[model samples]
Target chain A: MIEVIRSGLFTTIQDLGRFGFRSTGVPVSGPMDQTSAAFANELLQNDPNDPLIEMAYVGATFLFNKSATIAFAGAICEVKLNNEIVRDRSVLKIEAGSVISFGAMKEGNFLYLAILGGFKTDKLLGSACYYEAVNGMARMSKGMRLSFQADHQQREINLNRKVIGLNRNNGIIEVEKGPEFHLLSEEDAQVLTQTQFTISPQSNRMGILLNELVEIESKEIISSPVQAGTVQLTKGGQLIVLMRDAQTVGGYPRVLQLTEKSINQLVQTRFNMDFRFELARESA
Target chain B: MDNPTVRKYGSKAILIEWEAVISPEINDQVVKTAQFLQENHSDGILEVVNSYHSLLCFLKEKADLASYIDICRCLTIPISELNRTRQIWQVPTCYDTSFGSDLVSISNAKQLSIEEIVKLHSTGIFRIYGMGFLPGFLYLGGLNKQIHMPRKQVVKQAVPKGSVAIGGEQTGIYPQSSPGGWNIIGRTPIDLFNAELERPTPFSVGDSIQFVPISIEEYAQIETAAKNGRYQLKSVHND
Candidate 1:
């Protein structure tokens, strides 16, 4: 068992996502950065889709009541285990009564913490992903005890595996033409590809709003299906990118669809960060 | 109807869309195609979401976009044979001022008495066009033109769950408390969505719904019964 000493910012247990419920309008609330989550799980020799703790902006301080093998990824932060500083992207054997605390984040906005054998949580709709609407538990708070598998044998693994290519600061997000991309005039489309847009402070898991607006006369489409990574051009010329917890359907004109890797990259970027959308090659 | 255009929504989903219009005919095609795809395309397809004029098919893995588009184009299920079973749910609604805060304002805007608005809303059998925005939020069509009102200029931050509202040519029940701009006219006592249940919602796309107005006293009684899992929503087969 692990007790939350300090729940910083927003923290929740998430897997790949909840599936088989989009028809009923349930959003697939998963990790904002899937690559980091998978990397943390991979380091701990757990399933890539195993439920792990996801922290946004800040991370939580955990007190382990039992011995466990764990790994951390994403967001360069000062993580201390029992007052000893530790590095991320490497497996750590945690002893009972060990207290792991996270300091101020140095870079990125999201982090992933994975334990061996995964966390033992109730699954709603075949997913351990925490969605408040479905599971009724919001973010983790102080004094909350999280249950996990206790008796898993620790296995010997490579400790110094170098993880690379996760740097998302390039500000180049690749996108494809959405179904309603044709609605944009040639000049508007050119402006969209050429200009830089900053992430708005009003962004959340549901959608990411941009500080810049395009002057395009956008009309509402007949309410149609939308998903994560869909870039909607609203009537007010606001470019909103739907995130993990976005609604299943929307009425805004979906002008661009972000690549899967771009969704992971965009979520790691902080607010006010400028990014440009690049149209991917049609053949690629 | 002409063949619906099938295209890649993104890398992982395929969108089959009809003509850009909202009509019963278009909705029927959307529902039928969704049903056909859900039944036949199970290898890589995860699920299919049906809307008023399109079907978004989510794939388990990123499949060949061209092949999936070809498969969608090859769908030729006859409309008559592809008719899936549908139900007509009689939803218990309370139009009392306490439950519907905007009832008086909507009555004034439509230039109809409260009783007339309730009668007009209850008399029509609405068709479930789609479910979106919120979980189990049934987007219903077929509202009477007499009570058709535009959405509120400013959206309410918290429209109570089960608040039945009208927005332009559509009416729907808020399955959960959410920010909305629709003009609320009534509230339903029974829950349209329960996450604990194996089947979250009983109603589905292509199903029909009829609002049955009840008194405040009956509303309280039904609310209690529903909370205790004793209340069963009255529904019948739609022939």
Candidate 2:
């Protein structure tokens, strides 16, 4: 068991997400940076769908009551296991009663910590992902005890995976034309691919509001199914890129749909960071 | 001769758009397609979300595009043969002053008395057009024109669960407490979306609903029963 001593800005237990519930109007709330979370699980030799401690901006301090093997990944954060600085993206065997702390974030916004057999959190609707609507709690709080499998035999494998850090040079996000992409004028569409937009402060798991505004023709479609990575052009000319916890359906016109890889990259982006969009035609 | 257009929503989802406008025919097609996909292609399909005129099929695996398209084309079920099982749920609402703080305000805006407003709202048999914006939030159509009011300029931080609200040309019951802009006129005791139940949401798209007014004392009785899981929702099969 790991007890949260000091819950940081926003820390929650998440996996891939709750599936088979979108039809019932539930949002698929999961980790923002799935790529980084997956890497942590890979290093620990755990299932890809294992639950993880996803921290944003800051990270929580945990006291491991039971010794376990774990790994860390995503946005460079200063990690310390009982005063000894640890490296990211590598496996480490934590001793019982060891204090693990995370310092200030260095690169991106989201971080992940994966254990050998995954956290044994309560699964709601087939997912251990934390969604406030489903479980009534969105993030981990201090004094919360997270349970994990204590089978020491599971960590006997000789698994030493290479460290995979965030890609710093990739500033371009790829997207496909949305169903209502043709609603925008040619120049408006071109501006999306050409102009650089900064992430606004009013951003959460639902979506990120861009600082740059492109004048779009006012159009409202009948409420339709929308998903994560859907770029909606609001009537006020604001561009919103939906994130992991976005609504399943929306009334605004969906202008573009970001690629899955781009969504992973975009989730790690910090507030006020500038990025460009690259259009890739849907091959169907 | 009315075939829906299929397109890729993202890497792991396919969207079937029936038409731009909302109609009974379009809704029937949307619900039918969703049912067909859920019944036939439960293999790799993760979930199927349907709106007023569209259905999004989220797949669990990244299958080949050509093969998946072919599979989707083969699994088509005719609208005539589709499952038409639907229910008309009778939801009890308490429109008392304590439950509906905005009722008098909405009454004044619509130039009607509180009793008349409740009478008009309770008369309409609203159809569930979609389910979205939040979990189990049924987007129902058929709001009485006399009681139609725009959404509040400033959204409320949180409304209690089962608040029967009216926004623009639509009306719905809040499945769970959340931030909303709709003008709350009443509250219900029934659990529209209870996580403890096997099926969280009680209603689905294509279902019809009617609101029945109740006193605050009765609200307490029903609310207690609902909490205890003994409250039986009054619903009947619709032909």
Candidate 3:
């Protein structure tokens, strides 16, 4: 068992997120940076979808109530265990009654702490992650305790072994123009692909509100059902990319849809990060 | 009647999009298309979600989409019975000062008496063009022309669940508590959304609804019943 002594900025448990429920307005509240989550698991050799701790830019602190093996990955953070400096992005063994603290990150945002056996939390709506607004799994709070079950088939890795590397988050995303792609003028669609949009301050799990670079001519249409990755054109003509937590239906015209791979990139962006899109690969 | 412009959505889905605003005619075709594909779709197909003017059908990555659409082409769908299947649900609303927050503002803006506003709302047969934005959040078309109002420019911090409100030309319940910008005219005690239940959405597309008047005292009883998860709107009625 581990007890959180200090909760950092928006720390919570997350897995691969709830899928197939976007039509019902449930957001996939999983680790924001899935690539790093996958990479952490790959280094620990844990299977994909392993439940882990997702934290905002500032990391958190915890007292190990019991002996356990844990690893940290994703956005690089300054870390210490029992007052002894520890390395980030490496698996380590900490005995019971030890305090672990993670200082603020110098760059990037969001980090993952993966336990060897994975954090044990009650699954909700088929997702291990927590939904803040709705009743979701436990968020990291003072005096909170977390238990992990031993994977009977756990693979042993060397604690002294290190595969440490630090890299700032960098990536451009791809998307397929969607249900309303044809509705846009040919020049508009061409401009959309050729344009670069910055993530607006009004971004969250539901979707990223993007700045308007090109004026999209929207034909007034009735509202309809939407899905994650659906880039809706608000009446004001800016695009809002509906994400895992997005509403099932939207009145905005869907101009583009981020490919699943690209969606992963946008959600994990650091402050002030910008990305441009390429037209989706046509079917072979 | 199928439009000629059909296409694949992605590796796992196909889309049938009608080229017009939502109409009973278009909505019926969407439902029939969903039913036909669900009945005739081959292995690897998982589910079909019907939209007001489109049908999004999911298939396995391995399933060839062109072949799936071909199979869809072969399906002989019985023309939709949307006009007949549409049920009028009379929702009892208590829009007195205690229950309706924006009624006074609405009355002032629309230049109508509260009683006149309620009467017009109650008489209108709003269309359930689609169910979305939230679970059981019915996107009702056809607000009384007198009641048609734009949404609040800024969303409220928190809107109570079951808020009967208007945004642009549509009216709907909040379904659950969340931030919203709609102009709330009244509230009901109905729980339009529940996660534990098998079927979460209370209304399906193509359904029609009417608002029935209720008193403050009845609102209290209904609200208590809803808190205990025992309230049933019993709203469906013959048109």
Docking quality band of candidate 3, CAPRI definitions: acceptable
Top lDDT: which candidate number?
Answer: 1
- The lDDT per prediction is 0.87, 0.85, 0.72
- lDDT, residue A232, candidate 3: 80
Across B121-207, the per-residue lDDT of candidate 3 in tens digits comes to 888888776666665677677787778888998989988877888777778888777899988888887667666555555566666
- Candidate 2 at residue B189, lDDT? 93
Question: What docking grade applies to model 2?
Answer: high
Query: Which candidate has the top score in DockQ?
Result: 1
Order the candidates by lDDT, highest first: 1, 2, 3
lDDT of 2 by residue, A1-284 (tens): 99999999889989988877888888888889888998888777788999999988888899999898888888888888898887533677888999999877878888899988999988888888888888887888999999999947545644465456785526788889888987878888888788988888788888989988886675888999999999999988899999888888899999999888888888787766778998875431
Candidate 3 collision pairs: A27-A244, A27-A245, A249-B133, B91-B212
For candidate 1, give the lDDT of residue A69: 85
- Model 1 residue A235 lDDT? 79
In order of DockQ, best first, we have 1, 2, 3
Candidates in order: C-alpha RMSD to true structure: 1.8, 1.9, 3.5
lDDT value for candidate 3? Answer: 0.72
Candidate 1: interface RMSD in Å? 0.7
